[model samples]
Target: AYLSPGVSEHQVLDASYLASLLENSTSSYDYEENESDLNSLPCPQDFSLNFDRAFLPALYSLLFLLGLLGNGAVAAVLLSQRAALSSTDTFLLHLAVADALLVLTLPLWAVDAAIQWIFGSSLCKVAGALFNINFYAGALLLACISFDRYLSIVHATQLYRRGLRAHVALTCIAVWGLCLLFALPDFIFLSASYDQRLNATHCQYNFPQVGRTALRVLQLVAGFLLPLLVMTYCYARILAVLLVSRGQRRFRAMRLVVVVVVAFAVCWTPYHLVVLVDILMDMGALARNCGRESHVDVAKSVTSGMGYMHCCLNPLLYAFVGVKFREQMWMLLMRLGGSDQRGLQRQASSSRRDSSWSETTEASYLGL
Candidate 1:
């Protein structure tokens, strides 16, 4: 067993074997290191700050400014003619108010998305509550507008000849009340919480998982689906009424119905679909992986940004599209800063219209 320290055949074989074993062990270690490094790398669509720091702030800021101006103009035009407003105009006034409130909250959300929730929990709850309120109120107000138009068109002379003013006022109040009620969830559950992953404070929807899911479903159904159905049915009936009449104005009104419906669908559908997908993923129906989840997160942000634009679009699509609203805008501009010629022209036009036209103004203002 005691071998001499010399270069023998057995010693050569033993050294070569040991060298080969060491090489194999080192290769295995390197292979494991490579595997671990590969595993640590993130895939495409990983959640990151790139989306938050740039796109969200810019998008929200633009929306805020545009919404402010558009809604502000609508409110100003309506308020300037406050005493003369018809039931239709009254609903629009409330719609403008709701949009203003909704637009006001955008700066809060914008700042949060850009940096963090610098505003404390109280304001966070307030702002979030306003959003829900405005959302429900806006659509419900549109529904009100639809029904009002329906009543005015189909049974203007008979059904609403008495107590119409009082009835409309009550309906507006009721809409506000119901919107505030639905929005109570925000006040109750919209509290700020620290997200370590995002490494920032967030003022977000943080209800219990079950309640949150149910609430989201309710929002989609009541906030959008029901209103859409009501609007569609109302417009269909309105269209039927128009087909019986023959006027250039009615043709223009027919065009308006198509445009408004298309705009509503475009602005809202994608966002809700994205939200639904996110909910499904949360329920483990879709792939439960970071990449897919991050993609969904990005999509939600995008779609929500799109959704917020609907407030701005409302004035343009629903109100501004009306000839009367445009005329009002011109008159509003004249009141503020237009030339003497425009003012005289408006006055002359007003004088030229027959008294019978005055009775039709309310129905015309509703775009039907």
Candidate 2:
């Protein structure tokens, strides 16, 4: 039960129908080329088949630029310190790499969203695959980073430390493998299908009904929830450790943990909630109406955009916030200042009071 201030019945009804077909799974589903459905749909004036053509592309452009610069800086800084990279830094590097991969596809989607899918068929599939692969990869890498931090803090046993580099490498490999495996659906189902009404091709997934429902649920659980749970568990345990060892630093750890968790939830939960509601409504579990469906359709677009912000946020929350990273960046700046800046380097080196900076920094790298 909802109402828009301005909309016609045809607009509302067509919006509802288009919403159903957007992320839906159906054996009989095809592009809107079927003239019968298109004739009836008539492209709603209120909630057109396409999202806000201007706003969505602008958002994508913004995310692409921010993600590129932020993730690029992270990768460059991390690689520059390759010889001294800790386990957290290694995971952060991979996370940046995954973010860059996802960002690269945003411009393509931006163009497609604004106008039409002019990329033809093959590139459409490749773009779709890149979207799915790097999405899963980024989430999986975040969870991996959390788990690595958990192990180092919660159970820093000698055995665990033995061949730690190898362990980190292997874990990253496994994450990529799982991401590509999960994204196999895109490879199989994502393609450019012609829509007659629009007389344009769209890059989208075409899953059977049951498969669509399952994939939606799987994405909810695997793409977001499971990774969230892993991060929560690791942070909770890490917080427990900090609480036991009482200090001002403990409070900082608590704040960082809360900030990280809250940021993630705020950024991602709405999209998943909208998706879940869509699934439920489609299954007749929720009261369905044209008005509500239209609202949800609008929501799905906005929430999905919000979710993409994670690529830009990752470097800030997970990489640049570390004390060691901040110091290293400063050192890099000093080094980049030409030969006359040698004094800055000497002062920077002389200011290091703790021989155990690496150990302490590892603890802080998880936003300590």
Candidate 3:
């Protein structure tokens, strides 16, 4: 059941306590009334089972396949071009790694969602932890990319060259560290258990009494609010610098950064907002009664689906949005076809011709 908005976190705690109380007392029998009511009603169990078997699993399977292919291609391209690595490329590499790791857990989830969490308790905990690691790492990497762009464009000569290698290594290390730290809750809390009513095993978080509130708060801060604030501030600084600067090429690059930041915000904002709202609702600030259960369910479903969709969107943004990336991809493709040497020669010739033309035009303009 979903919690109502505007509900105090304490209320959610109380509700959980109440649930436990009910489970231990006459309230458990009350659930039997609800179940009997549900069972007495005509429901298409066979059709539901069939849909789960045929449609849901197939859809998730397709998602897994696409995610693997897309992320794998990105990793290969980034690794192959390691000699030309920039701050952006460093972040992209981490992003690709995060996506690939996240996708690896999809098969487990697909099986759990379609049939059951056939995997044992250990697998469930590990998969759940990996999922969180991927999510947090991706978010942090995106934030890092935004800051890197801001530094590169606004501070340019000052911050771009000095300590770059060290900065890249540190940022990469910090991102992974934060990912593991935030994912620890998932590893600690996730479990697999058989549900008697559903006659299937489920894998989900099981927060301890002492740590539940702390976990929720940590999730709110680390998973959503902190990253959002970082991204927003970095992009704001980038915009301010762009507006104050005058170079056309720099302006164009700033525009691309803006696009990336905006896309990231748009894609992720709703999901986080939903999560925050759900947390609030769980606390008993929203709807207190059981009548609003459907609304909670809908919100949960939408947020969950949107969060998953964000995983697939990152590769497209990274690989397709920038001119440099496009050029790199084209070069990579040509090289894959064994024409890299010819392509390099063509590029060299074009560069020389452009340089000669620029010099001649300058001389003519000066009448020299």
Candidate 4:
């Protein structure tokens, strides 16, 4: 039932259709009775119930496993690279930590999905808070990484020695603070309740009218719009800097940033847009007619799938596009295979030479 960023729309629609088919028929049940039973329930609630029954537990199980392994490995690798902890790495470490925390909540979600939040009120609050906190923290850390890249490239000489460790720590604190503040509503609003029609107990949010509207608005701005704006601006400036850089090495760094930022944007933007639309629909700003409802349901299914897909994408991004990360991964693999380590040694030597050459070229450019 949770919306994620990587699931395909077709898969969601197919899942939904399959769920509907399952709920409506059995070899022994009469078609008329099945139709009558379905018609008696609220469409949205019935769809949600069916969807949860059919897909959510399995989906959460898969995500939990993926997130656990991927994020755990990311955290371990980032932590082990203590000597290479630049401002960029600092942000990345925080991002990995945030993502790992989010993964920790997945098991709870899986339980809730399968068994309808039998964990009670306190667990509900804790799970909801952790989920929101980690999600927003991850987003904020991504923005921080983008800004760090922008500054490192565009203001390289001036900011090169700027110690961002303390600043990054402070910013992380602020992000957590804001995340908690925003997430308080989830604590106050979400509760486990019994669904009378379905004869099932479940966890659900119960926002006051004003609070619900505000939460939706806040989600649109903080969760989607603000981060998008910041990432877009930083990457745009970074791209401009890269395009004009005289050094091939600098250009290469910029190109890497472009790929990272572009991948993030492409993966996340649709999910956010769909979330905004869902909020709008909830607020009655969108029509509630059958066609619109169907459209919204379809959109929800697609967006949720995509959002889940996002969780698996970050590790791939780091492994493939991050030159340092790729090197580290390759080294780790070679060690595991007990293969020749000469290639890694050669790469290290080549990297040192490249660094020396870059320094010389920079000195020449500055007439030093």
Candidate 5:
């Protein structure tokens, strides 16, 4: 190589040094470019897709059958006795209604999970709103039932004593109104939209990120946490009162209490916890990547199905467990089946004596 006359040995760079520097710079640039490309590429997220297709449809279909049958039976029994409904009866009736409404929407979700959202946008919004509305109403009514039990037992105040059926009806109206308010967002934002990645349309929330976060937070607090807190407090007080009392009713009440608490926790807590994790991930409070997101997706699906199954357990836990309810249900079934009128009358007369004794017990609401 030729050097300029003014260039000194110190000022001139050796060929090897220049070559090494150029190589280093090129490698650094290439690494940076590669990093940028990786960041820009969409991450693979098929971890839960196959699992969801196989799992969600079956879970949803089973829930639909169980919930519909259970809630429908409760509704029939409650409606048959509507003229003489106690405050507890009124709450149970509405709870059954809420659960039924929620269950009716499950078929749509099942079809969506198995294939795609072919129901179109209007039906999607309506079904989504109904599902959410009943979800809130059911939880609130459970809280109301707990409170009713507290008043009837702990305070020794008979809700039906003062012609409070009107009050109970009004409370149910208020619950429905509040649930409607909570679900308004779903009506406005949910739609069946196409997903290119999945090659299907999905019925889902369509909102800004901030709006989604806010809506989810509201749901978590109002729908689940608030009701859970209310039930916890009211039942805790009721349990304290029941503990000091003496009777067979006490033992039965203790069992009823355990069943109620365990059933609620098992069905609901996991779903809400997974939802909380998702909310945290959205807010950047938790580390999130494709793998973690896929796991969360699977968890949400499984847990939400578990939550849906809660509707099936409600009728068993709240109604059939009660002796009075069982009698009423038996009467309803006999009538529906065209059983012998004379036999029905004899059974009714017998039940009246048994019911008189049951009515005096604190757990009469449970029909225990």
Candidate 6:
């Protein structure tokens, strides 16, 4: 269960009836007489609502465009491959699929942000569930990629040796299954409801207080901390091995791993930190006032947008960074233009030679 911008979730659940009464109050003189009694009412945040109206739609639309094009191209390229996939390729393919699915939900959110949840209750749950499923799936798939890289490079082993195809299929199935489990709350609790204060409909979860707190904690742990730990440990060990070895190719691969970790942290850290604060406030660990609520609400809105930008960055970091993938993309483009087979064969040979830094290290680029 979560909150959208506008009226704070804490305020919405606790004070909506009071807000409705105040909205229905007609006499200014009666309000003046009872002004002291209404002093404790949650303050209206015109700025947050106005910001959502102007800012969220534009940002969401931009994210949708960039994420769609990048992830779509990634999916197309990976799918075009005729040979069997390595473990890293399998992980990357699923990551692209998850990101593409997540991006598809942005247009609906864009509309919800600009206007209201006019799609009604059923679509609300479906969209919200899809969003949650893919968000968690992307994070888990990234961890899987890092773990697969760690095994191939540092341990000098594959994630599976026997029945490689079966293992890859099982891994993907497990990832999606876990994502669905994590997002079960959304499917069960998310619904489109009218926010009388902002005079707009919002699609948000309606979990009990304990459930909301638990879900937020789950998000912080599973979505951010676990992935961070796995990626950091895997890459740190990979870098250690690379540093001991002597080659410019190894150095370049080392730099790539560092960029991936840093990019993930930069894109996701602030949003999770904001979520932490939200949890604290909800649990009464932090003082909850309208001023703080307003600021956190706005901060969450902005940081979550920044987090979504990573969907656009993943293709660049994971796919385009690979020499083999780039060569494949070029061959794909050339083939579409009726290029000769001999030229394609020559380019493929050159790419294979150039991409071979080390068997294990090159696999990090999905070059295997």
> Which one wins on lDDT?
6
Candidate 2 vs candidate 3, lDDT winner = 2
lDDT of 3 at 189: 66
* lDDT score for candidate 1 against the true structure: 0.67
lDDT score at residue 83, model 6, on the 0-100 scale: 55
> Which is the winner by TM-score between candidate 3 and candidate 4?
3
Q: Please list the residue runs of candidate 2 whose C-alpha ends up more than 4 Å from where it truly belongs after superposition.
A: 1-51, 158-162, 334-337, 340-363, 366-368
TM-score of each prediction: 0.79, 0.82, 0.75, 0.74, 0.86, 0.90
Q: Quick one: ranking by TM-score, best first?
A: 6, 5, 2, 1, 3, 4
- Name every residue pair that clashes in candidate 2: 33-196
- Give per-residue CA lDDT, model 3, range 1-368, as digits (tens): 11111122232334445445446555245555567443433222333344445544555566678778887777776776665455666677889889888877877776875777788889887888888788778888877776666565446532423246787888799889978887777677676765543466667655654465566566667766787788788778766765665656456545555666676667667766765666665576775333244344344444544566566777776665544444555666777788869766676455334321111121110111
Q: Compute the lDDT of residue 126 as modeled in candidate 6.
A: 87
Model 1 Cα lDDT, one tens digit per residue, 45-133: 32434675667778878888999899998888778666566666677889988988887888777777677788888997788878888
Whose lDDT is higher: candidate 1's or candidate 6's?
6
Q: RMSD to native for every prediction?
A: 15.8, 7.2, 8.0, 8.2, 14.4, 3.1
- Worst lDDT window (10 residues) for model 1? 1-10
Q: In order, what lDDT does every prediction score?
A: 0.67, 0.69, 0.60, 0.60, 0.74, 0.78
lDDT of 4 at 34: 72
Worst 10 residues of 4 by lDDT: 358-367
User: 304 in model 6: Cα distance from truth in Å?
Assistant: 0.3
True-vs-predicted CA distance for residue 227, candidate 6, Å: 1.0
lDDT per residue for candidate 2 within 165-222, as digits (tens), equals: 8877888889888878877777787666654434455665555557767777878898
Tens digits of per-residue lDDT for model 6 on 1-368? Answer: 36222234644564565676667777654767778757766766766667777888899788888898999888777776635356676778899989999988888887877877889889888888888888898999999888888888889887654346788789889989998998888788888887766667878777678998898888889888999999999999988987787767777877788999999999999999989999988788999887887888788888888888899999998887776777688787888888998989887677555543112444434342
- Among all windows of ten consecutive residues in candidate 6, which has the lowest summed lDDT? 355-364
